[model samples]
Target: MNVTLEQARALDALARQGTFAAAAKALHKGHTAVLYALRTLEEQTELVLLDRRGYRTRLTPAGERVLEHCRKLLEAERELEAACAEIRAGWEPTLRIIFDGIFPAEPLLRVVKQLRAEGAGTRFHVSAEFLAGVEAAFTRDEADLMVSVLPPTLPDLRSYRLADLKAVLVAHRSHPLATQRGPLKDEELARHLLLTVRGSDPRLQLSTGALEGRSTVHLNDFAAKKAAILEGLGYGWLPEHLMKRELRRGELKALKLASGATHLFHPSLHHRAGVRLGRAASRVVQALTGVELPTPP
Candidate 1:
């Protein structure tokens, strides 16, 4: 009940560093001080937090549970400090953004580079998620911005469309289907393997251009899918921007499919409607959407 931040920090360091000496070095404290902090923590909490019986000190099961809560406390403290820094600096401490994996990364990197050149102080955490995973990550992380293919379904959301991404069904130049002239028949497509990206969200049955009865191999990202296709392992849809050089050089050939050779995926940038944008986030929005947003007051 009376545990202090010092005690929690010592426990965390011990768990991470694995030994009293290491933990002490990490905390910039003497070994005795680190031991005392952890002992006091155990006394105050009435829990045997560490098991020192073995040659190596380890946390008891109870210690692990307490450490979890302690980690949350430490994280909240860090967030509080960041918030204060943001207030003084007039930039968000960090901007968390999640974008669809199908969307090209070059554009995002260009925006980030521009922001860095302009002396934006906000730190960036960017991730690419597939299908419903994009929205799930945005909500779970309370992300400041998201680029997603899913349309905004919530009333509290604001969205603007970016350029549509083009996905082309492709096969390796040496694959049997690559030589076929006319639109590929369903029966022929069925015989060949379809390389597809597995959705980042595990709970959802999300996929694109997967034929009903074809044999398929699921990969984690477009890069892997492209690799597999180029290796002649299978044929699948890949983002056009990703394989232009390969297509032009005959390393990969776009499949002429009966259903469709090309698929257009529309992605939009979204943020919470009522929340004011920080300077960095606003600049990023302008870079992506070409519409300047007002910075938070």
Candidate 2:
């Protein structure tokens, strides 16, 4: 094929920017240059790439398929650049991390601030998952590092214990369950609505701190779960660190269950075994482990 990376890039930019003029501005090239690149690409491929049938510029069917491949090519180019940088310097161009919802944010923020202050040039992509969701992210290779309450038992994975997070079953002061004076029975607790975090895996539909066969309110994230509980919607377990203020102010009351009221979740830092981690990933692991920070590169 006579296609070049520049032609693919120009096509991708044009598709993203909608018009040749906008694409030219985005690529820092003249309008004629942008048009020429796309025109050359179509001629080489023997396909009409753009449809001018409507007022708005749209990609033809073949154009859409070619654009999709071009996007993949662009992504590969970026990865190539990052790989080159890693060979020259011991630093990664990007680091992706996934944290379970129960993991504390304060410490993570502090660590990120320190990384930034140290002039770490690595780009960060952070996301939050819950329960089995963390394991799913790791399994799918979505993140370079993961902080999870339940570490998957995969042969290719390695884990390091970071910290134990404490969780307590709590309810708003005005809730019916909160009025009970002593340890709650399973049946009594199960009678009320339970707010729980929904797992991402459709096959599993797993949950923590939730009773089966009970009326339940399922929220996608911890923040929403906390909000639902605060509104007296239901009682559910929350990370102690997240609700300490509410617990202290008596806005929420921790329940004592006959079985157990508190649970300790051991969160661990996990990564793929036998894979060399970049400098930024190494530093993040140290931060999570409470080890002394390494000298800045």
TM-score of each: 0.68, 0.66
What's the lDDT for all of these models?
Answer: 0.85, 0.80
lDDT of 1 by residue, 1-297 (tens): 876789889999999999999999999999999999999999988999999998779999999999998998899889888668766766887899999899998888888888888776688999998888788899899999999876755578889999988878889999999999998887788888887677322232223334634587889999988889988998887889999999899899988866678877788999999988888888889999999877677
- Which one is best on lDDT? 1
Query: Which pairs of residues clash in candidate 1, taking residues 3 or more apart in a chain or in different chains?
Result: none
Model 1 segments beyond 4 Å from truth?
1-86, 199-214
* Model 2, span 1-297: residue lDDT tens: 777788988998888889888989999999999889999999989999999888768999999999999888889899887667654676777788888888987766777788878776677877888878777886686578888877576678867898688888899999999999888877788889888788223332233234644577779888998999999999888889999999999999988777677877788888887777877788888878855434445
Error of 2 at 240 (Å): 0.3
Highest-scoring model, TM-score: 1
The C-alpha local distance difference test score for the whole of candidate 1 amounts to 0.85
Model 1 TM? 0.68
Report how far residue 66 has shifted in candidate 2, in Å.
31
